[model samples]
Target chain A: MELRGKELNKSIATRKKEVLENTSILSEICQFLELKDVARMRSVSKIMNVIIKDSQFIWKPILQRTFPEVRILDHLTWQSLKNVYKSLRDYHYLTFEPHSSYTVGIIGSLGKLKPYPDIHSPEIESSGIFGGYSNYLLGKHIISISVLSIPSIKSIRKLRAEIQCWILQVNGQAQGWENVLDEHVTNFKMNQIKSSQILIVINSDQEYKTDFILDLEKKFKIVILKYIDNKTFENLTKAILKICRNDGETERKVYEKQLIRTNIDENSVQETNDSNNCILS
Target chain B: MFYNFNKIEEVKIRLRSAEGHICEVEESAALMSSFIRSMIEGFNEVTEVSLPNINSVVIEKVIEYMRHYKDKDPPIIKKPIISSKMEENTSAWDAGFIDADWNMVVDLMTAADYLMMIPLRDLCCAKMACKFKGRSIDELRAEYHIENEFPSEMEENLEFQHPWRLE
Candidate 1:
C-alpha cells in the first residue's frame, strides 16, 4: 500500500507536472503564488516566463480571496499583490475583541470597541516607528489595558532564554546570543530586527527544532499585546514575524491540528464576517 | 451515517473511483458533489457512479467530508480572515478535513474541481493560500518544487524587480 501510494504520487506528480507545464495548469498553480513571487518563479525558465507573462488570471483568485464582500464585474488593472496583501491586512486589524477570549484570562483586552465595556480604556503609550508600544497598567485594569502581564513577560523572557540556550548549545563555545547581540538583553540594542542577520539566526536555529519559529511568534505575540490597538500590533507583528515566520501562525496552526477543537459557528463568514466585525487575534 | 430501515435495507450508491475502488455511500452524501447531483437527476436511479479522474484516496477523503457535511453545509470562506477563535477550533471542521499533504491536497483540489464542488475547492484553495502567507521566494520554490531558471542577468536584477519585498 505504501509503495502503491508512492507510485501513485510519483506518477500523478510527473503527469501533473507535464500537464501543468504543457497545458495551462502551470498558470493555474501560478495563480496560487503572489504576483511578485510569480515574477520570481518566472525567472526559472523561458516556458515559465512566457506562461507568467501571458497569464492574466492571477488577479481572479486574488480578487476573490481578498475581496469577497464586493462583486467587481469589471476588469481591474490590479495593483501589486504585495499592495493587495498589505491592504487585505487591514482586515486583520479589527478593534473588536472576541467575547470568548475576553471572557477567559487567555487574552487581556486592549479595550473592546463595542458590545463590551472598555473597563479601563487601556492607557496605551505609542512607540513611533516599530509600534512596540508598552505601558504598564495596574491590577484590575490590566485586561482593559493590555494582555501583557508580569507572567506573560516572564514567559516571554523564558522563551527568549530557551532560544538563547539552544543557540548557545548549537554554537558550542563560539559567540553566544549575548556576544552576538553585544550583551544587550532586555531590549534589542539595534533595530536591525528584520535584517538578514536575524534571518540567518532564524534559518540556522529552525533546523534544530521546529518550534523555533513558533517560539519566536509566541514572544512576538506577547510583545504586541503590550500596546496593541488595530494596525499597531499587526504592523509590528508582521514585521517581527516576517523575519522568522514559518508556516506556523503559532497558536492557530497548532489548535487547528487538534481537529474538532473549534465548534464555534463560522457560518456568518458569508454575510457579516467582514474585516470590521471580527476581533483581532 | 446509517439509520434504522425497519425491515427495508438502506439504499446506497456505489462510487467507483479511478483506481476501481468502489465506495458505498448514502445517496444524500453522494449528492454533495454537484456533478453527482446532476448525474443522479438526469439518469435513471443508477446505483453506481464512476469518477474516472479521482482516485480512491481522494474519493475516500472527499467522502469523509461529504459524510460529515451531508446534513449541514460547510462554511463558505469568502475573505482571508484568521479568526481569534482559531485557537479553540470551534465550528471550522472543513479546515481540519482539508489538512492533507501537498500531493494529496493538489489531487483533492483537482478532484474537487472536476466534481464542481466549489465549497471543497474553495476550502482547499483557501488552505493553500493560508500556507502561502509570509513565505519567502526561496521557501516558495523549495516547497513547491519549482525550478529557478533565471538568466544570470535576471537573477542579478531579481531584487530590483520587486523593490517592495526588499523593503
Candidate 2:
C-alpha cells in the first residue's frame, strides 16, 4: 500500500518558510537539555544560542528533575569541597554557572575518631563534620553531615580547618618520615604486620641515663641501637646471627645473656620480617 | 445545475478579512473551516512583533501547522495520549519524516524546535543520535568538528600513571 501524497514544493521560499516557524520550539528544546552554556550546545547554530539565556525561557518540568549524584566527587575522598568544586568546574560539568552552587559529598573530621560521650577523654577534642559552604559557594560543593544537636562552634571550626589542611596536602606522601616513626607505624594496615620488634636507637652522651633504657634492657628480644661506629654495627649483626646458628644449649644461653645485656636479638627479628611476606596490607 | 442570482443582490452584501481586508467570503464555509480562521488570528497576534534573527520560512511552516490543526482539539493535538498501536503508528511516520540528509535534518530540527513543534523536533534529534551511535571516535570528530586533543599513548598512560587513579 503506497501511503503517500504529492505535497512537495520545489521553491526555496516554501522550504524556508516552514523552517522559520519551527525555531521557537528548537530554542526551548535546547534549554530543556540543560546545555545552554555547553560549547556543543552553543554550536547548534547562532540564532538558537542567543535566546537560550533569556529569563523568559520557562524550561519544562522534567529538566528540573535532579541529575544523578556524581560518584566521581566521592572518589576524591581527601579533597576539600573548595578544591573539588574547582576541579569539577574546570574539568567536568556541575550545573556550572557564575551564579550557581555545587555540593560535594560529606566528610567527617579526624576528631570524629572519638567514642561516645560517656567514654570520652580530654585529649580527644570534640570535632565533627560540618555542612559548610565555602567561597562563593560555587567552586567545590559538599553536602555536610546534618547536626542533630547544637555543637560547640569553635570545635567544629577546628575540625573544618584540619579537614581543609588534609584536603590540601593529599599528594600520596605519608604524613611523616618513615625512618622517624618506623615502617607501618601510621599505616592503616596494622594487621599486615604479624609481629613487631621494638628497635630503640639511643644516643651515647653521658647524659643518656634514663629508667626507660634500664627497663628496655630487661627484654632479651630487643635490639638497642646506639651511636656506634659503622664497623661495630656490622660486627654486632654478625655475632647475633652466629648465636642463632649455634646448637649447644650452653652457647645459646650465653647468647641470650648477651642479648639481654646489650639489647640485641636476631632470630626473633628475622621471624617478624618473614610474616609480612604473604599479606597485601 | 446552477441557480441564477442577480449581480445587485451579490453586491448588496460585503465580507471583510480578519486583518480588515474587504473581500468576498462565505461566512458559513469560514466557520466550518476553523483552521484558516485561527491561522489568521495567530498572524494578527504574532505579526508586527519582531523576532530579530528568525528567518521567514520557519514562520510560514508554523502558520501552516497552525492552519492544519486550529479547529482540532488544541490540547489533544499538542499533547497526544497514545495507546501502543498509536505510538507504533506515529513512530513509523516520524521515522520516515526524519530520514533525510544530515544537514537538512538538523535544519528542520532546529526550525521545529524554535517554533515549539515538540514531536517532530524530538523524533528528528533522536534519529540523529541513532545515526551517531557506534561511530568511531575519529568519525565522530570529523562529523562534529571535535578535536582529538589527547596526545598519543594518552589513553593507555592516563589511568595507570596518574596518582589519583591508583587506590
Candidate 3:
C-alpha cells in the first residue's frame, strides 16, 4: 500500500538544523561539548570549525567556566589566556632540573634559607619545577656565596664608614630586605668584631687590621627580582608595596597602610641614633 | 481539554505547528516558553501564535516540558549536568520526557531553541553531548552520522598525537 496525503510532513528524525544552521543554537551546543569533542567537531565541517574558533574569541567566559574562582584579569587577551592555560597544562608533566650558579662576596645568604649561613649545610638541590615566564625562576634555588672583607681601612672612623658601606651593599643585594637594627650594626659592629676577634684571627698587622678571618656562617636567603612592568621600577619601597598589592585585595590594603606608617618614621625624627646603639644590635 | 470541571474562565493559547496543526494549551503553561511569553505580552489581545518551523510531534514534546515546569521554575542545571547523577537525581518523569531516539532529541532541541526555552535546549544538548563522550571515532560516526574525513593512516597518527583516545 502506498502512503498518499494532502500534505507530506518531514519526520523529526531527519532534522538536525538547530545545531547545524542556527548560529546561537550552534554556540550553545558548542558550550556543552567536551574539549576533545570541540577539537573533533572542528574536523566535522568548515562551518563547525569556524564556529568553534569564533567561540575562543569570547574566551574570557570560557576560561572562567573552565577554571572557576580564578580572578582573570581584564587585560588578558585570548592568545595570552591560551598560552597561560597551555603552560598550566604543561606544569603537570614537568620534570625536575638542577641549577648550580654562584655569586661572590655574600657573607651568608643561601636560597630562601633563614638563620646563619653554615657551609656544612648539606649540599642541597633546588626544586626546579617552575621556570621563567619571560624571566622568573620560581621555587626554591640554592646559591653558593663567598664572603669578602673591607679592601682597605685608613682609621677607626674610616673602618666604621667602610662597614656602613658593606652593610648597604649586602642590604642592596637583598633588594626588599628590612632589618630593625641594621643601621645600628653598621655604625658599631666594625669596631666590636675587631675587639671580639681572637688576637690570632687577624690577616694583617694588629694596628691596621683591614682584613680578618671570621667564619661566622649564618643562613640568609638569596632573592633577586625584577618586576615585569617598567612602571614598578620606582622607589624600592613603592615597588615592594605595589607587588604586595598585586597578590590580592585584602593584602593590598593592609600592606598599603604599613607603607604609609613606615614612610613617616626617620632616624632623626624618631630619635634613634644608629652611631650610639649597642655593638651587637 | 483541561481537567477543570468548575467552568471558570481560563485563558487558552493557540499554537500553529509547521505541519499546519493547531495545538490549544493553557496560557499559564504556554507562558513558560519565552517566545510565546513575548508574543502574549507583545500582543495582549492575540489568542493564537504561529511557529512555522516546529512540527506537531516536537511541539507536543516541548509543551509537555513547559507544562511540567510551569508552576515551579525548572531547576537550572549549572556547569552542564549530565551523568549517572543526572539520571539518578532527575525525576522519573523528566527522564522519561526527554527519552527519545537521538534524532527526536535533536528535533526537540530545535523546537526548544526556536521557542527560546533554555532549560529544554540545555537538557537536549547535554544529552547529545553525553552520547559523544567516551565514544570512539567509529562509534561517533555511526551514532551522529558524521563523515570520517581522515584516512586510516592519518587517523592512527591523530590517535597517537591526542593520546586522550588511548584512555
TM-score of each: 0.45, 0.27, 0.49
Best lDDT goes to which candidate?
Answer: 3
TM-score of chain A of each: 0.22, 0.20, 0.27
lDDT per residue (tens digit) for residues A1-281 in model 3: 13433222233223443355455655665565545455565445445545655664334455557644232322344344444444445653133233222111112221221222222211111211111101111232211122222222222243332221121123222333234124323433555533111111111111211111112211111112222122111122232323322445455445444433343332111212221110100
Q: What's the best-to-worst order under TM-score?
A: 3, 1, 2
Error of 2 at A182 (Å): 51
Each candidate's clash count: 11, 30, 5
Residue-wise C-alpha lDDT for candidate 1, range B1-167, written one tens digit per residue: 98666977656889899889898888888888888889888998888989989899888898898899899987765444343122222245766676666677777878888888877776666655555444565665565466776767876666565554532
Error of 1 at B143 (Å): 2.8
Q: Model 1 in CAPRI terms: which quality?
A: incorrect
lDDT of 3 at B104: 80
Strongest candidate by DockQ = 3
- What DockQ do the predictions score, one after another? 0.10, 0.03, 0.13
CAPRI-style class, candidate 2: incorrect
Cand. 1 TM to true fold: 0.45
Residues A151-250, candidate 2: write the lDDT tens digits.
Answer: 3323323333222111110111224322322332222124221112212233222222235334433432233222333323332333333332453555
The lowest-lDDT stretch of 10 consecutive residues in candidate 3 chain B is B80-89
